[model samples]
Target: MIKFNTKTNQRSDYLPAASYSLVKQINSRGVYSFCMCPGGVIAPCATKNNEIVTNGWSPSQRNYPTANSGIVIELKVDDFKKYSSFGPLAGVEFQKNIEQKAYKLSNDSQRAPAQKLLDFMNNKLSRNIPKTSYIPGTVFY
Candidate 1:
């Protein structure tokens, strides 16, 4: 998931809220954006203990100062082959593993692990992270 500070962009304040969908192929993998929300907040949506998952949503008025979205990569069954021993539940196990790992990375808290967009693209750790709409907060990683 990614988010941008809408408060810095004056145009976003007067324009109607919008959502976007983007699809592309990179390194033979399908990458796409899902549940894009203008003037939205990143929300925690974990369904189990020792795990973390996130989603985004906007209020009816969409007046928040941030916009966020989930960028997902399409996964094929082969992607979860490591958990194939679980049969049909392999994908579930794979997803659980990722969520649990994220939880651990965030110091076993609700705070999500995060890196600035530029730092991430540059493959470096962010020296600081700006404020975000995530209620539980975020920890630069």
Candidate 2:
């Protein structure tokens, strides 16, 4: 999930809601925006204990400062082949594993691991996180 800086021109206060899809390279995986929520919050949507999943949603007024969305990559069946031992549920198992990993990484709590966009691209941890809509809070990781 990504949150736009409302302090800037990217704020949802003026821009209309939008979504995007892009392929960075030929024959490579495509990334697309999902659940684009203008002036929305990042919700914890985990369905099981010891796991972490996220979704996005906007309030009725869509008046929050930041906009957020799920920037998802197109996944193929082959991506879960490593978990084929799970049979027909390989994909589910794969997703579960990821969620569990996130849970573990965040010290086994509801707090989500997060970092600033620029810091992430620079392969470094953020010194501090700005205000966000995620209510359970965040831990830089």
Candidate 3:
């Protein structure tokens, strides 16, 4: 019954009509404002694969559009239920696993698999583990 057209009607490149108008109003000669940090400090946001990363920018200083691209894979309703073991908290669960694995391989209790400066220089794992990123939420850990 559903036609499922392959064609898409995407109108937004990023900003909407009203947002563009606001920037037009403020681009004056004496504005003298640069290095404009919009929502400074990166946040630990994840993509579909759950690789945590941060994003932020400085205007005038960076001298470019405050934009960062993300690689996202599309999924359907069936995709949501794909991971049979992770019935509900799939994303959170996956992060915990990463931390735990990284933790056991880590030196300190923080739970992030880490190597020492000398170990890194020697290209070896340190016998004395240093630190980890695993927080209190790792129930399985």
Candidate 4:
């Protein structure tokens, strides 16, 4: 099945503006790309307790149909203020809230919420979900 990751409307090019720019030491958190898997498959990342996370993996031969990666975004300490009741453990609470919400949306199972790329872009529900590599299954949104 085809998949598109980003929600942006702009088209992409082999070469684009700002393609060779880098800014450093700005005292602001930056996003980094990591957890890349080449020729891999998406995997269900969930606890037995029912939290939905998406991860990816490849076989020992690295011969899967797709690739996946994680874009890590740095969160400053100040960003945890909304979760301050738990104090320094706010980040944990924040993550828990996300997992809990996902479980609630996915019928309290390990299944993760999903939508077809076109339906997502059109802001409508997908009448049919394409086959996925994930084994835990998906709950279409």
Best candidate per TM-score, number? Answer: 1
Ranking of candidates on TM-score, top first:
1, 2, 4, 3
Weakest 10 consecutive residues, lDDT, candidate 2?
18-27
Comparison by TM-score, 1 against 3, better one? 1
Quality of model 3 by C-alpha lDDT:
0.36
Clashes by residue pair, model 4? none
For each candidate in turn, the TM-score is: 0.79, 0.75, 0.24, 0.60
lDDT of each: 0.80, 0.77, 0.36, 0.67
Candidate 3 per-residue lDDT over residues 11-86, each given as its tens digit: 2333321211111122221222122232132233334332333334433333232332222233344544545578
Give each prediction's root-mean-square deviation over alpha carbons: 4.3, 4.6, 19.6, 9.1
TM-score of 2: 0.75
RMSD of 3: 19.6
lDDT of 1 by residue, 3-25 (tens): 34547654434444444667889
Best by lDDT: 1
lDDT of 4: 0.67
Model 1 bad stretches (over 4 Å):
1-21
CA lDDT, candidate 3, residue 21: 14
